[model samples]
Target chain A: MKAQSDNLVEAALETLKASTLRVTEPRRALLRLLAEAEKPLSCEEIRARSEGEFDLVTVYRNMEVFREQNIVQTILLESGKQLFELTVEGDHHHHIICRSCHRTLRLELCFGGELERYASSRGFKQLEHKIEVFGLCETCSED
Target chain B: MKAQSDNLVEAALETLKASTLRVTEPRRALLRLLAEAEKPLSCEEIRARSEGEFDLVTVYRNMEVFREQNIVQTILLESGKQLFELTVEGDHHHHIICRSCHRTLRLELCFGGELERYASSRGFKQLEHKIEVFGLCETCSED
Candidate 1:
């Protein structure tokens, strides 16, 4: 896991270099945090894990830069807080959120094949699609 | 369309009454705006459409309130801006975001199905996922 995380960090650094963003400790720390995090984390969670080395504003600002450069994806949690994750470049996917526990499940499927045709039919010009589903997990339902 | 929008407003009002939220003009207007908007709208867009009736802070606050009550769905736009849309009760869906035109297409497949199983195997317990995808549309690709 540690070696894989190192590779993730290296990829993040390359992304930063390619985007012409300055390589800063906070940015590097964020990359490490996301790479190691078991789930999507908010700015507050990232700051807490950083041990106060960075403030919330820094996280927000750097995240904005990362998003603009397509290095990170900001997902809107049902909690209404923005969660950050490293974008899995070249592979598109969707998510299922546990309605009971707020646990997120990421799935890989380009399900917009039908919607693309639907949009063209309406002349609305379909551009993109994001999909998230909320439901009970097996344990939650069992309980 | 106007009649449909009005019904949405009425339904939203009923939802507010069911929740702990206080129904105010700004709140009402925000719900209406979300109901009628073809795509999720940012705070700035909502404020602009509201015609200066509500401040950005008020819009932010109302957004929090509506989201908490489940009266509206908040969309995480690719631009990192939060957008608002009225949730279609009992219907599960996701979106396709166009990278070129910033247009959003809604899709009906529960793509995150396998992720939950994956999480269960990993013992992540109560795993949930939020997924947003961005790419060029057929129109944008042709352009």
Candidate 2:
């Protein structure tokens, strides 16, 4: 696990360099956190998990930079919350979030190609799709 | 068009009563706006179109009430903004928004049923899906 994590950090650092972004400590740490996260995390969730290492505004600023560099992607939930995750190349995916617990799960399924084609047919160009599924997790449903 | 709009207001009033919410002028005007709209609107957009009739804080408060009653649904965009639209029964749909013009068009196509089944197979219950397609409109693309 440690070795895998190290590789993730290494790759993230390379990503920053490739995007011509300065590799600051906070940026490195935020990248590692997103890279290692099981699911996309909101700004608040990221701050809480950072253990006081980073302030909220700093995190938000770094996230905006990361977004511009395509190092991270933002996922918007129906609840008007934004979640961020590392943008791994060749691994396009979506998310399924538990409405009760707000736990997000990565989804491998993608139908963007077809959806994009449909949008293009309708005279829309540069199509990007956001697909989010909300549900009750097993524990929440049981409760 | 006038008759259709009148029916929309009537339906909206009925919706408010059905939810046991008090019908007021501001609420009625807001509902009329949503009913006549071509797409989901953000609070800022709503205020701008209100022609200085509704205060920003009053709009926010009324929106909260509308959401609680399920009269209006919120759509979160990748830009970290929230959009609101009326919730019409049995007419489930999504949207394709132009990032440049911020114009939204109703998408009649839906694949939520298939997605819900997939989530159920993965142990998720009470699944709801949100799909938003973003891009440039024809005019915006030409520009």
Candidate 3:
């Protein structure tokens, strides 16, 4: 587990360098937190893990900057709080949030491939797509 | 346009009735606002359309109630504001948001069909998915 976490932090550091973002301590820690998250995290949760080593304002600032640079992606939870996660290695995917357990799962589907073609046909160029599905998970399904 | 809007409101009211939620003036207005919205709206926007007839507290309270009854669904936009939209008539879909113009197009696909099968084969169950793609619209791309 420790090795996996260490690798995640290291990879995140590399992402920052590759994106022209400065390697500040707060930024580094923020990236590490995002990379390690099993699901998306709100800004408050991100700050809590830092043990007051960084200010809340700093976390917000760096997160906005990193998102602008495309180094991080925002995941929305059912609770209406925006959570941050590292952009996936390649290609893009969407999320499935469990209505019962509130658990989140990543679903990779080019399902929107058809939608893109449709848009292009309509002369709506430069199209982008985002999809979210909500329902009972297996555990909640039984209950 | 007004006739179409009224029909939408009527359809939404039927949904509320099926859920056994009592229809009141505020609830009716809220549903109408969501039905008319081309995209999800912030709480403030919902209140604005209510023309000061309903207070913010009422909007928040009714939204919570509506969400619990599955009469509405919420999304956290990239802008970090929580937006509410009417769930489609008896189906789930995603959104394609134009970052430049903030226009949102509804998207429908097979609801995690094959992917859910794959995940189930791997011992994963209770999946939920949300997908959002961000990019410039045709006009923004041309600009």
Candidate 4:
């Protein structure tokens, strides 16, 4: 697991360099966390998982920069919380989140092509869409 | 325009009464604003439109109560802002927002039934989904 995590960190570092973002400790830690995470994480979740390494305000600022650089994408949930995940090249997907536990499961679906075409026909350019499904996951339902 | 707005306020009052929420001055005004809005309004927009009749904190608190009572629904934007809209009976829609100007357009298309069925098959109960599209609108693109 540690080796795999290290490999993920290396990939994150390469991404940062490609985007011309500085290699700060907090940025490195956040990128690694997002890269290795099984699901998208909110700012609070990211800070909590950092084990007191980074502050909430710093996480918010870094996330803003990462978003501007396309290093990460934000997933907007129905409950109005924003979650972040690494934006690996050619790895597009949607998310299904458990409302009770906040557990997110990635769905490898890309039905946005039709939606994009529709938006384009309506004179919208550079169209992007986000779809988030909410429900009770297995563990939460069982509980 | 005055007559139309008055009608909308009546509808909002009815909704509030149906949801068992008190028809307070701020609540009534907020609901009326949402009812007459062409697109979702953020808290800042709401406050600005209120013209000092409602304070920022009062708007926030009223929004929370409205949300709990299902009198209003929140639309999450990619910019991490939550916009409020009236939750009228049988009125369902999504949104497409302009990235530059933050203008929002209502989309009557709802393609969530199939996705909801799929999620149910996967053992997810009480499934709900939110879809938001982002792009440059005509004015923004022209600019």
In the order shown, the candidates' DockQ scores are 0.23, 0.72, 0.44, 0.60
Candidate 3 residue spans exceeding 4 A from truth: A1-20, A33-39, A91-93, A99-102, A108-128, A136-143, B1-8, B14-20, B32-40, B73-75, B87-93, B108-129
Interface RMSD of each: 5.9, 1.4, 3.9, 1.5
* Native contacts recovered by model 4: 0.72
Cα lDDT tens digits, model 4, A36-80, are: 887888999999999989789999999998887777888877666
lDDT of each: 0.72, 0.83, 0.71, 0.81
Worst 10 residues of 2 chain A by lDDT: A1-10
After TM-score superposition, the amount by which residue A48's alpha carbon in candidate 2 deviates from its true location, in angstroms, is 3.6
Candidate 3 lDDT, A1-143, residue by residue in tens? 76766676677677678877778888777877777777877789899988888899998898888777676777666665676777756648766666666667776656678767655654467655556666666677675
Please state the error at residue A51 of candidate 4 in Å. Answer: 3.8
Candidate 3 or 1, higher DockQ: 3
Q: Per-residue lDDT of A21-126 in model 1, one digit per residue for the tens?
A: 7898888888888888887778888899989997889999988888777777766656556777777666566655566776766754455676565555535453
CAPRI grade, predicted model 1: acceptable
Native-interface RMSD of candidate 2: 1.4
Candidate with maximal DockQ:
2
Ranking by lDDT: 2, 4, 1, 3
* Per-residue lDDT over B1-143 for candidate 2, one digit per residue giving the tens place of the 0 to 100 score: 77776776787778778877888988888888888887788888898888879798878898888877777888877677888998877878888889898888877778887788778888999788888899999989996
Model 2: residues with Cα > 4 Å off, grouped in runs: none
lDDT of 4: 0.81
Measured on C-alpha atoms, candidate 3 has an lDDT of 0.71
Docking class of 3: acceptable
Could you tell me how far off, in angstroms, the CA of residue A52 lies in candidate 1 after the best superposition?
2.0
